[model samples]
Target: MILADLQSRLRIALTNTLVEEWTLFTPTTGTSRPSARTIAFHLGWYLRQTVERTWSVDSEYDRSGMVLEQAVQFDGDTRHVPDLIVHQRGLLGPEHNLLLAHVSVDEASGPDDVPELSSAQALQRRFGYRYAMLLDLRLHVEGRRASVTPYWQWATLEKGAESPEPVAVYTPRVLAEITERARRAGD
Candidate 1:
């Protein structure tokens, strides 16, 4: 599948899984919420499950062994570590065998988190990966109630550019459409 299509499908799968399978909030003394690491783990798990369930078995797309804090080198010298890297199965190394670099974000994330996205995008440009995705799980705490909103941003490599441009925003309606499409395709 193409990059956009894969991104759309994955977004749908993640949103649905988050809404249906998981509870977002737990009671705590002072505005407790899910940490970025916890969110990342759930995202990775659901992403792998969705890919396995929806994609064709013959496609040979393996979402296993998603590494965390993987150090990658580019430009012959510079090295950067990203939060998570998803690549095809049987790839020899991660330097050039990345399918997507997922940057996780939460309420505490800020400008410091941006460099990771840039680094992932740079790697995508150098290696011609389909896209890089940022998965932001924003939590809002009010009194005793907590709410979470999930945002998906896709960066696609633009022609002749060194880094990717924000190509699409995966909103709820788009995600719903993609989910329905995936269901129909599976049937």
Candidate 2:
């Protein structure tokens, strides 16, 4: 798929997840930061609906059966499992590895602190994915309520480039509107 089309579909999936899965951002109980995996699961569900049915959308799927020599080590493991991936299940090449995404929720870290961006780049280089993205959702918990703001950056490795280009899923104004909608829904 083309970059613009993929980006458009991603935006729809994110918007749907933010609006429909608002509860995941705000818990009625203790105010703990939301889980990145949990949010990615929801986002994957929506993304699956938007993408072509032939592509399988999965999370933490590391059973591709291919040897990753240059894979980044994390948490004492050499295997790199992306938070989300879109690809054909049996094939393991650039033609099949369409996209890979690393998801995170951080309240104190800046974009520079996001190590997932590096992981994304490594996975894209190793797996030869056409696109790799880092979805960093910033969440703040105040008492029983929480607020979330989403940001994303992507790299188009189709041309064998290593640098990732930052992309905004939502403009500042639209992001504020989405946050307000979630807050009102929670209230």
Candidate 3:
């Protein structure tokens, strides 16, 4: 399929998940449940970030490049879509190996990878997330305005675990800043 077509299909899959099974995205443990838009934005942000990292090896596409293969659920069932997936293969069906990927950023870290946060020690050093960014098929959703949705940060995940006990949420203002920069650039 053409790149545009593939992207459209993938988004369709994301929407389908939100409409039919977003409830399944519950923390599986926590009492708080983020909105669908938040989830979508989280997934979208994760995907965009992955493409950026992958672009180092596959220069054919930019950091934001991805074939766009959408679906709900970790297995495209119930109600769960992962945040991101690697766009390795050309525009086609699921990869022979895998497509979806998960990601998380540690807001508490410094540029030097210093131990700004407890999870900093475990991050991929440069781009690795503080928590497990599992690639669930149901990830990736649109948020308020034109932004990626929010993502779930499981307490069991390292980011939360390593964090200083309780009230662990990383709302990176960096994305909003980037969005503003992009908007200004386009303007």
CA lDDT of each prediction against the hidden true structure: 0.50, 0.75, 0.32
Q: Write the per-residue lDDT of candidate 3 for residues 12-81, one digit (tens) a residue.
A: 4444433334343433324443443454454454334334343211212323353333231132222222
Give the C-alpha lDDT of model 1: 0.50
Better structure of 1 and 3 per TM-score = 1
- lDDT ranking, best first: 2, 1, 3
For candidate 1, lDDT tens digit of each residue in 98-150? 35544444556554544445566665664565556665655566665444455
Model 1 steric clash total: 0
Q: Please tell me which predicted candidate would have the highest lDDT against the true structure.
A: 2
Report the lDDT tens digits of candidate 2 across residue range 2-121. Answer: 877998898888888887878787767345656778888988999999998889999866765555554444322444467799998878787888888877777464554455556666
TM-score of each: 0.58, 0.82, 0.23
Error of 2 at 49 (Å): 0.9
Q: Between prediction 2 and prediction 3, which has the larger lDDT?
A: 2
- Model 3's TM-score against the true structure: 0.23
Looking at model 1, residue 175 earns an lDDT score of 47
Q: Ranking under TM-score, best-scoring first? A: 2, 1, 3
